[model samples]
Target: MKRFGLAAFDDQQDDKEYEGISSAVLQRQNNELKEQLAVFQERLVGFAKKHNSEIQANPEFRSKFVRMCLSIGIDPLSLFDKDKHLFNVNDFYYEICVKVIEICRKTKDMNGGVLSFDELEKGYFRRLNVDMGDLEKSIDMLQSLDGGFEIFEIRGKKFLRSVPNELTGDQTKILEICSILGYSSISLLHANLNWKPFRSRAVLNEMVANGLLWIDEQADAEALYWDPSWINVLHE
Candidate 1:
């Protein structure tokens, strides 16, 4: 008895069937994702227009709006590149960028122009339920203004540095030392950085005024000027 060899034929048919099903599933998924993105974008664009003032004034709402933007790949600040009449989103984000800078400057006095990302987020969230990720995006936008607004991570903790002036040799040295020691008093700067006592006091005080350092006044103790920018990231 002769039997037809049909094993190869069956395997080939199964393989073709599997490929066809996979391709159809993927195409459906792609179309669905595209449709969802369009709907989300339209909703947000409408929100930006009707609630421009409220979005600018409300931290929580603004934070939510920002997250909405990032997920949709919409950048508010980019509106300046094209005709403003095209979309209200551009104007909305343009105002947001300005507000972020203003907020940074307003709060800089407490931290010497440098605030821990954790601390900043907490403060905003405490009062307004703001999102850190959104604030980070706003800070990123502020960098284009030549305002020295940048976010840095030290030991895994993020920091917001808000200052327009370039750091001097002494200033950079102080930052390097603080990255290790977590704090630098005037004496430390004088001893380690070879700064004179008067120079240390002068520079440290200047940094404090510029929002570059936090000042801790202690009775009968030399003032402790610490870098608020340093985050002692605790390792587990």
Candidate 2:
């Protein structure tokens, strides 16, 4: 029995020694990987600096560069230290943010601070010469300021909401129906959604008050509530 006890103690010691060796090996490998990543990042910073002019001047080049960095789990923007003017990509996105805000503010009355991504692309992106990725990044940066810049999807259609008010569930449902039919009337809501007449009317009226829905009193029957964003689509 004493011999057996000694044998067990030796086995435990061997197991602990194996674990220690495995841990040390893993730690060394992790350190080596981190060092490699650091070297790669430094090289990338150099490359970005060398081509800074092209990256800023050519949107296609900038997009490809940004995509390559992203694929490697790096943000090209991070290559620039806060004080480094020549390496700064933030300026590019900052300009986009300013332009987005200006467009939203100017069209707030026409679209009620809610514009479809398609409309935005058609009306501004071509002139601004930026891609959707750039606009999305600018939107993310603006979110920190809490200025109600957000993107929401209804029925797979994306719209930028520039207003501070959050959409209620009922309001969103109405919007989804509008996405399908281009307009929502009290009868349509009741027939399709099983909503009571007053419930449909109340939500529709509230949206009209918010400038989210335009009233078509000239419809053959009941007034139809329409999304202003669909006006262009209707014409097309």
Candidate 3:
């Protein structure tokens, strides 16, 4: 007897092939959707860049941009759109940007010169709501990061180009007690630490040298004074 050709498939097998074709079609549709999303993202980035360039080219436009951002709580440095236009910023970011802008403006007013640490601290306090002490510490950290400033002496008085770092917790407590008790002597610092000071007067002397503390010229022969700036730095 003649056998049927293999091409003569069973009905059940035909149904399975039809289902496989349908699954393949669905996967193609999904891939097409993803491609469309990518194209949309690219278009958004292009729009953002166009607006940013427009703002940067005109100072009036930049000021307007800042105003518009402020109206909507957008910080120019914090969040950017698809094109990197800053938007939707929190209060902290806005404050930081404002302070930085003020500093830039002040530097311009000063004929492109650096502001003294005291001047900078006052600006920070007035513009950013940062305490004087906190301002000093932050400035110190910034100077350390950028290496642009240092403490100096002029005419037998001290001034800082930048404040030094705040003391550690233990150092802070010891220093605080010494300040309150009118003890600037190394012995006082040691006594405050239960007579087990880590580095001795050598460390205290180094702090003084670095402008972190001071030796009183008018107190008892052995009196020392924790720099008032240290209090500001630590508390701030």
Best by lDDT: 2
Q: Please say which candidate is ahead in lDDT: 2 or 3.
A: 2
Candidate 1 TM-score, true structure as reference: 0.43
Tens-place lDDT digits, model 1, residues 1-236: 33358755567667899999999999999999999998987787776766666765677877777776877787654322233343344454455566566767787665566667676656444344336655666667767867577666655767667765656767656666676766777778778777788888877778777767777887355887777644334331
- Sort every candidate by TM-score, greatest first: 2, 1, 3
Over 100-198, each residue of candidate 3 has an lDDT whose tens digit, in order, gives: 446645553232222345555564555434555544454444444454444443333223432234444544454455445434565676665655444
- Lowest lDDT sum, 10 consecutive residues, model 1, at 78-87
Clash counts per candidate, in order, are 3, 0, 2
Over 1-236, each residue of candidate 2 has an lDDT whose tens digit, in order, gives 34565576677777899999999999999999999988987787788888877777887877787778878777444554434454346766776787788889998997778888788778787654566777788888988877678788987877888999988999889989998878999999998999999999999999999999999999998999998888888877
Q: How far is candidate 2 from the true structure (C-alpha RMSD, Å)?
A: 14.8
Ranking by lDDT: 2, 1, 3
Candidate 2: where are CA atoms >4 Å away?
1-87
| Model 3: residues with Cα > 4 Å off, grouped in runs | 1-173, 178-183, 196-199, 230-236
**TM-score, per-candidate, Cα-based:** 0.43, 0.62, 0.34
